[model samples]
Target: MAGELNGKIAAVTGGASGIGLASVESMLSAGAQVVIVDRDAIALKAICDRYGDAAIPLVIDLLDPVDCATLIPKILELCGQLDILHCNAGSYVGGDLIENDTSAIDRMMNLNVNVVMKNVHDVLPHMIERGSGDIIVTSSLAAHFPTPWEPVYASSKWAINCFVQTVRRQVFKHGIRVGSISPGPVITALLSDWPPEKLQEARDSGSLLETSEVAEVVMFMLTRPRGMTIRDVVMMPTNFDL
Candidate 1:
């Protein structure tokens, strides 16, 4: 499995930390040259340095529609051929809906939903031209369940679920594979928004998933044969309850 992705090129958004970082590491170990995309230049530089030539850093704030539009083209320019694109950059907004400001909601939705869609849209023409490619969007378990505590965040992922499915249908004929990985409560900065008591409870119950665990699922989705597309993978900690 170490060289399963040898000769492939991958671009992962939010690759500076957390799930994105873990996925980048996984891809590198599999022998793929990965482009690490993130807004933090320092983190990008550090990661790229640690991984040497296999990890390429691209720093851009994906929240800017103008910048997000440039992502695919930039990756194409850098890698020549982008075999995989993991839209893992996202933001979290938890707590009662009324407690969140409109600006925060807009930011979360833009990063979680809009950016994923835009990146996928921009990459399609290239992948379709090649007649083969893999696209994986990082979704969340909230997308499939009604979460009152984080209604806005859940709504954003729900939109992602629909988007991934629809695009998968449209691109299957082009030899492109589209899918999403939905994991629950991964231990990342995203959990900082959770109520302190709830966070503690999840910790006590061993209901938190590590970033590496989710990255393994991402790898699983990416490595499957071209003939079979994994539509979506929903994973959560065994102790995690809705």
Candidate 2:
């Protein structure tokens, strides 16, 4: 029997590890062929090893708009048609906004918003033709709440959530569904910068949402029929985060 997502094609960014990697696994398990894009060599290869032909791994730096533009066409060529895009690649490279270096702020803006907009612009034409496709982005809770210690990161995420909301309004008329997943801290390689003591404390708080939990939100959006759309989903850890 064919899987629920049999014959579908998905492209995911920051897909080599963390929430991105988890989404890759989730999509594949649902029977969709996937193309994984990330800057990491080792993790990308591991993804390919397990899924083999069903998964294609590409090394990409999202901050580079050229990669975003180029990858858009490459995805269509590989899949013959594109059905879904999961723009889940992002990083936390900021301190407080006032003392933050200008370069770091620029990088965060480019990676978090500019690159994603470029990719969306490039892929939207084809998706428009079909008038049916899935677009899922991973935002953050900091998008809505305050992050005094990481103002730039907070601003970046808030902007991302705004982008998703605005795009949802623009695309829904065309039958293209757009949604974002806002996940509270979950264990992942992306959190490597946190000191061990701080990390343990967060985990012990008993409210961390696992990668699978976030994946379920993505699944819900995709599995929804044409009759409905999920604009944004904010997932909280039961213990600490609201």
Candidate 3:
């Protein structure tokens, strides 16, 4: 039998590292042609070199609305048509609101919240026109809880959660599926920024999640049959408190 995603085209944002990198590898293994989008030009070029024709690298910042608008069209120009979009690029800022600098909050919101909105806005029209597509946003478990340790990061996720649900409802008739994966405390560079005490606590408690696990979930969501849609997947390590 053929690979489930053979002949499909996918675009993965923040595809240079961590969960984004893992997701890109998974999609390629499943026989999809993918365009890896990221601001890390060096890393993106390396991936393209490693994967050769299976990967196309686009090095551009997603913060600009114009860049987001051009992304899908550029992906289509490369691979003909788009079948999947993984909005997996995001940043995390951990600390109390008072202690955190205003600049940090602004950057976090712009990256985690605004960028996501722009990408979705740019991609949705094409998906609607084609009447088929799958959109998977990399959400956080914080979206479902009051994560006092990372309130701004939590707020960004909360906004994404709402966007995914509302957009799913709006586009269901157009044969597009929009959903999010809410994973708890993934072991990525993002976690490196956590307070040392909090990191130690999670390490002692064995609550840290691996990036590949999240990639597997993204694969699962994308490979489902046409008529089925898994709206939200809430994933957490067994010992995590929230």
Please, what are the lDDT tens digits per residue for candidate 3 over residues 31-73?
Answer: 9989999999999989999999989999778877677678878
* Residue 104 error, candidate 1, Å: 0.6
- Write down the TM-score for model 2: 0.94
Best by lDDT: 1
Model 2 whole-model lDDT (C-alpha atoms): 0.84
Candidate 3 off by > 4 Å: 196-201
Candidate 1: where is the Cα deviation over 4 Å? none
Stretches of model 2 off by over 4 angstroms after superposition: none
TM-score of 1: 0.97
The TM-scores of all predictions, comma-separated, are 0.97, 0.94, 0.94
RMSD of each: 1.1, 1.8, 1.7
Backbone atom clashes (below 3 Å) for every candidate: 0, 1, 0
Highest TM-score: which candidate? 1
lDDT over C-alpha atoms for residue 36 of model 3: 96
Decide which is better by lDDT, 1 or 2.
1
Residue 108 displacement (Å), model 1: 0.9
